[model samples]
Target: MAEKTTSTVPKGQKSQFAVPYYEISYDKFFQFGVSVDCVVFGYHENRLKILLIKRGAAPFMGMWALPGDLVYPNENIDVAAQRILRDLTGIDNLFMEQTKVYGQVDRHPAGRVITTGYYSLIDIAKHDPHASAWADGVYWMDLNEVPKLAFDHSDILKDALQILQQRVRHQPVGFELLPEKFALADLQALYEAILNESYDKANFRKRILSMNLLISLKENQKDVPHRPARLYKFDKQRYDELIAKGFSFEL
Candidate 1:
């Protein structure tokens, strides 16, 4: 018999170069990469808060662990926890649901190609979810006190925070739901119901009106079963101007 030919090989490894290769169907389109991160927010004592943790390891060691990792890849359940809240309001795009994705393979030399972060709202005074072992000292940092975090997280957090700050006003379509002029009592009830908590009525009014986003019309609620309350309406001109200049009607 004739000897078989060798296309290529190491000096002594005759068969090493002969391995067959097969082309799999549609294998090129499988570049799908998915990751989930979250911005967990809560409200307590009229101050907005978010959950954060100190990194106890490298890549961002001693810095904040950010909203794109640390609570993902291993958190396989309880994501349904937010669904209850979602269904309660029957609203979509409630909070950062894949609203933005950081997709750049080289984003992390560590290995992920694509990433996404979701945001959720909660009552801060209630639960305390623990962070990963690599994350130490999990704390509810006041939104106003959020320190510089690791990675591009600061930008992500800032954007998500802005959405909620603005959304709380327009969502539940509150401003539109109110009549042109409304009583302070009705307005306070609107906020309390939406926020799922009570606010000190006097303080709530003071803080909300202090923004100067509302106009006190020279009118009062008419034909109410109770004492007539003052009336006010959202100032379209003022609201538009402040929003253009980065104003937030945080409740």
Candidate 2:
């Protein structure tokens, strides 16, 4: 049996990978730290708000930044993001989807550090997000009022807000920010707030009501100076039934 020779390159083609390959000591190579930051969005008072904390320690100390910290060596990226959100907002089991990775050479003051950004949407009235002692202040600032943030957080916030705007228009996640019982006007207000635009009352109601996903409640709004509006609740069961029957949702 003669020895066989093999090449990944095709017989008729030249190998473009002519460059040599070598390995160096892993510890001697340039290394970077990884962290997770969260853009926690809350919808309240008919305005979209994002949670921000005043940095307590050095390296942009006293400046506002997205809630975050360095990822531990043993932690999964999702768990790290959850930890960041949990520590900042005291909410557990959040679906903190990774939005983007930021790795500019000079983004962080702490040498080479890259951060994974995540965003969360929640109802503000239901949960009062608080800041730890480390943070001098914590507030749900309206998106329009977002100030210059620490590090590249301002950019992260910009991208996350854009994602929220797009996702809400096409998904049922917007219902998560609303109470179990709501009015047609309430839903429209939410959409307008997120999309930063208004919808014609007649068209918006006709289209949404056509879906038949709302359960009209007998109760009406109270304690209002204006005429009370009829309340309705999202029928998740109906939505699921429609989905199973190959009906897709769209705005």
Query: Where does candidate 2 stray beyond 4 Å?
Result: 1-25, 28-30, 240-251
Candidate 2 steric clashes: 0
Task: Name the best candidate (by TM-score).
Answer: 2
Per-model TM-score versus the true fold = 0.48, 0.83
Q: List model 1 lDDT by residue over 34-112, tens digit each.
A: 4544677765554567777677766777877454442234344235324322322222334445446676556655655
lDDT of each: 0.59, 0.80
Supply the global lDDT for candidate 1. Answer: 0.59
The candidate scoring highest on lDDT is 2
Q: How many clashes show up in model 1? A: 0
Error of 1 at 124 (Å): 0.9
What digit string (tens of lDDT, one per residue) describes model 2 on residues 50-141? Answer: 88998988799989999988899889989998877777657668777678899887898878888999998888887766776467667889
What's the true lDDT of residue 30 in model 1? 51
> In candidate 1, which residue ranges exceed 4 Å CA deviation?
1-33, 67-96, 173-251
Which consecutive 10 residues in model 2 have the weakest lDDT in total? Answer: 19-28
